[model samples]
Target: MSTVTNQAVGKVTRTRGSRAWRPYLYHIIVGLLSLLMIYPILWMAASSLKPNSEIFTQAYTLIPSKLEWNNYVSGWKGIGGISFATYYKNSFIIVIFATIGSVLSSALVAYGFARIKFFGSAFWFGCVMMTLMLPHDVTIIPQYIMFAKLQWLSSFKPLIVPFFFGVPFFIFLIMQFIRTIPHELDEAAKMDGCSKYGIFFRIILPLIVPALVTATIFSFYWRWEDFFNAVLYLNKAQMYPVSLALKMFLDGESISNWGGMFAMATLSLVPVILVFLIFQKYIVEGISTSGLKG
Candidate 1:
């Protein structure tokens, strides 16, 4: 019996040892991948701090030999033509309105699809799904012409208003998430004398916080990074977003301010990073819960 006990103890010890080593192996793999992902960002930050001369130098140093913080200062002032502050404001305004509009409109439309059964519901849903199959590039010219005819050119209206109508992808995502919730809850609410709007506002909205966060984060990121449309429709420099303003830093005629340009590029990425970090937990939870239900 003592020998058998010892044998069992030995097996348990081996299992414990394996478990400890497995985590270390995972850590090493993750560390390597993290370094791979972070290296470019580190290189960009280092280059931003270096003088124009040091950027192309043979030195493999991550730390700049001569740090010029003025690159950031000058970058903020922008090139000869524009100001980064104005661009920042423009981008912020567009992102705020677009994010709110997209989230609210998508949630409402999603609720309609998920909860209500009306005539041609499946057909309309199919149409919405088909929109996802069509590329935005394919519809850009028609959208641009429509906007131009409506005299929305050179304004933030084009960027902001479309979101209020609901984006197809976000609508689909939210609809899936809503469907994951049991219909019994809605029935119970209705039995308790709650109206459909009341059920939506009080119960459904609270439950789908994760989906809303995910949608908001996505919308904000897209609006912030939207340069193609900004360039296409916006003629006035004052109306350009940070995305377009960043391009002005590159002067192909003579010498581009590589340090300043990189500094601005790094700065440009901060809002996106912050927004992601803020809602990352909700985004993950929302997707996970939505998958389990549907």
Candidate 2:
């Protein structure tokens, strides 16, 4: 009986010990994968500090033989006498206005779809949802012609104006989030003599802060990194955003300033990283809860 009891205790101990190492093993694997994913970004940062001649020569090395801070200074000086500061200013102007427009318009439209009932509402909602399946590439030509006809080409209007109508993806995301809120709250606000706009502004808007923040972050990222639209609509070098300005480093007719390009590329990532770190929590909470019921 004593021997049997000892054997059973040893078996339980072995089983518990085996399960404990699994978590550690899982963490190690995940850590390796994360490192692999971020290695390119880390390498680029290191390369920015390397001598221009050594960048491609020692491409595999993450450490520079000697730091070259001049790369950043040269990059900031920019092309055609336009400084990086101008590019940054242009980028901020487009991103801020477009992000605000996207978030506010999306929220208002989403509220109507989720809470208010009107004639042909379901049909209109279906049309909005169907747009998610449509690619922006399909409509680019038509949009370009329309903007051209209005003489809005080569201007910021083409970049920022469309966002005022709301983004299809964000509209759906906010609509789903709004649907999760209890209707009783809206009814109660109405009983207190709250107007429709008051219910939206005072009650619904405040409750959906997480979703709004999520939309804002996404809109900021999209607008900040918009290269295709910038290149398509912007003709003047002085009017270029950072995304388009970066391309000026490449001189097809002469040697390209790759080191300067890499340096500015590293700097451009700062705002994006800061935004993500600041609002990451809301992104997770908003996405997870937005789908809870609707």
Candidate 3:
């Protein structure tokens, strides 16, 4: 019996080892793929340290022979009229307002959809989903015309105000997350004489911090990187966001400044990368646990 038990245990261990090896193989492949994806970004950072002459030299080296730290200082000063400081301030203002507006509006709308049962609730929910299916390109002209009529052109209002109305994708994401919270909690709050607003502020909001964080991160990134709308609406160079300001580095009529461009691009990515790293845990948790309806 002991000999038989020992043989069975050995076989089980062998099976477990094989299954573990399968995951390890996949992990190794994924690591290599990640490295491939990151190589371009790494190359860009390295190239930022190189001088203009070394950028396109025949004996192109990944490592710069002489680091030009002043490139960052010069890039921050920007080309002639526009300054990076102004663009950075513009980006910060837009991103902050937009992120706050998107998160708050989406959460409120999502709560209504997830918990409230009223006349035409289903129809409105369908409308929200339908809006998601429609491409933004199709509506851009109409939106532009509307904003133009309002005289919101060449200002941050175009970027900021629309976010106060709930975003369809964020609405859907938060609704799904809100639905996962047990209805019993709502009932319990009501039993304690809590009003709907009270329950939402006290009970629901705390539970959904991860989702809010995720939405905030997305909003910040989108608003920060937005270029097309900025170009379409903003005519003043000083009013431009960093994304639009970066275009000033191009000569348009002549060759572009590749080294300065790369340096600025690298600098632009730092804030985004830092924000993601800081809130990545919340994002992962929000995505993973948001589907479990309990």
Candidates' RMSD to native: 2.6, 1.1, 3.2
The lowest-lDDT stretch of 10 consecutive residues in candidate 1 is 285-294
lDDT of 1 by residue, 16-49 (tens): 9999899899999999999999998888888889
Off by over 4 Å in 1: 1-19, 58-60
List ranges where model 3 is wrong by over 4 Å. 1-27, 58-60
TM, every model: 0.90, 0.97, 0.89
TM-score of 3: 0.89
Compose the digit string of candidate 3's lDDT tens values, residues 1-294.
999999999999999999989988999999999998998898889878888788778234578889988778778878776678888899899999999999999999999989988999989999989987898799899999999999999899998999999998888878889988889999999999999999899999999999899888888899899999899889998898889988988897987777777889998998899999999998888877666763
Error of model 2, residue 252, in angstroms: 1.9
| lDDT (10s digit) by residue, model 2, range 88-146 | 99999999999998999999999999999899998999999899999889999999999
Q: Candidate 3 lDDT (Cα, whole model)?
A: 0.88
Candidate 2 lDDT trough over 10 residues, lowest sum: 285-294
What RMSD does model 2 have? Answer: 1.1
List per-prediction Cα lDDT, in the order shown: 0.89, 0.94, 0.88
lDDT for model 2, please: 0.94
lDDT of model 1 at residue 269?
91
Model 2 residue 206 lDDT score: 98
